[model samples]
Target: MFVFTPTPGTTWNLTVDNFTQALHRREGDEAYIHTHADAEGSYGPRDEHDWWFAFSATGESWAGTGSPAAGDHEGVALDEATAGAAAEFAAWVLRELVPPGAGMEYNTRVGMESGLPDEVLTENTVTELDAVFRKHLKASSS
Candidate 1:
């Protein structure tokens, strides 16, 4: 799974399996689902192409061309404000990625973790999730 904070108030969570299945169903291509882990203790698995992108708190961004292992999965540590923004992004992603004919099976655990700062986990969290997903899709494509 890939996790990140697209903006100050948003957390993005994504799984390779879910993404691959959704893309296959929508684009009818299976290449997007093809990825493998290179390192044993990595947070997320590395793709054969070794492409990985991550956003850090120090305003640092990382992307490279090397295989990553499943243990390489990383989480987006967010504050209350940022978490809220992430929820909105997640909602946008759901709207765009979830196809009309696609069933709930394609749904993924793409959301913030519970026990977050109450201020961030407000009623709008769902919206943030959608927005986060939208941002992720855009970034992944580009």
Candidate 2:
């Protein structure tokens, strides 16, 4: 799991899993991300790749949906202010590498510990995040 604070108010948390590493597959017409990577020393049983993207403000969490190419997950509800950013971020991720699919999972991690500072989303932060995303996307794709 990786946590990024691109802007002051917004935070993105990315989780990665291998296609076969998940204990259970996504059920009921849900869309999923897939990937493969080699096993690390301590982590056991690894596969190619799988990933999920999410954002949060205060205690509220939001996830991206591939369908309709927007934001909001099945369980979490986002407020008006953060909704657009969350949707934009999610949609960006989905469009970048995640192919279109149904039942997209968002807000997959809510209770997980955060390592980012508490701050409001700022334009500078968003810009920083964009650079980071592009770098990561480039590296991963290669």
Candidate 3:
């Protein structure tokens, strides 16, 4: 699991295994990846806005916004089990999550506000990653 807050108004939580399950359900295979976007509410500066994307492995490897007929957002299930699909998805996330030149700004802001080292922030983000994923799983399963 991994969590990242690229902007004040958005956060992302990703899980490698549950994502695998979702991908399996979507693609009818065990070795595939999935990506999805969720509309989550924002607080602070961007209060009342909807922004957030949570991607998990489901058996697909495509990307898009909003919900799809299969589910929400976009996903793609690759034919091969190579890391290329995951790498491409991650690259897309890195590009989409935070715009260029804003990384430093957000880092400084969050650093000062939290009064924690970058390592701690990274750890917290990762912790929240699985937490959110599990919550979603529980909800869907029920």
Candidate 4:
């Protein structure tokens, strides 16, 4: 049991720093919160964020804040808010499947991708992933 969802590439209605700060404040024992953004944002404009950063969870519980791995960008094409809306929809399906009292139990040091949605998602697994996001981006859409 236990399934997980991943965060979508949504442009939070906040400045980059503000978003980062907000994520820092978002910690809880209730669930795992994976937060990330374009790493290129650190070197370039606020809009041309292409470098992907996978972050790890620090302390107990996922606080949506952590340090990215040494490298950046997994080359996984994403649909951010300014881009396509697939991530938004994938997030929706996973959220709809979540039941009460669901949250991630494991703390991971490895970052990049969350093994979620499996090949097929079920309500049973959805409730188990804890508070996963973007639970369906990697699914087989055939």
For each candidate in the order shown, give its overall lDDT on alpha carbons.
0.34, 0.31, 0.32, 0.28
Model 1 worst lDDT run, 10 consecutive residues: 103-112
Runs with alpha carbons beyond 4 Å of true place in candidate 2: 1-81, 100-103, 108-142
Pitting candidate 2 against candidate 3, the one with the higher TM-score is 3
> Relative to the unseen true structure, what is the C-alpha lDDT of residue 17 in candidate 2, on a scale of 0 to 100?
31
TM-score winner, 1 or 3: 1
Residue-wise C-alpha lDDT for candidate 4, range 39-124, written one tens digit per residue: 65343223232222222222222112222222132112222221013223223323442234432122122212453222322323
What is the TM-score (0 to 1) of candidate 1?
0.26
The sequence of per-residue lDDT tens digits that candidate 3 reaches over residues 69-142 is 23332222222222333333434344443344333111122233445322212222323433433443344345
lDDT ranking of the models: 1, 3, 2, 4
Better of 1 and 2 by lDDT: 1
lDDT of 1 by residue, 1-142 (tens): 2333222333233444544453345446323332455467364433343333222212332222212223243122222224333443334334443334321111112322322221222223465455644554444445
Candidate 3, lDDT over the whole model: 0.32
Q: After superposition, how far is residue 12 of candidate 4 from its true place, in Å?
A: 4.3
What C-alpha lDDT, on a 0 to 100 scale, does residue 6 get in candidate 1?
A: 27
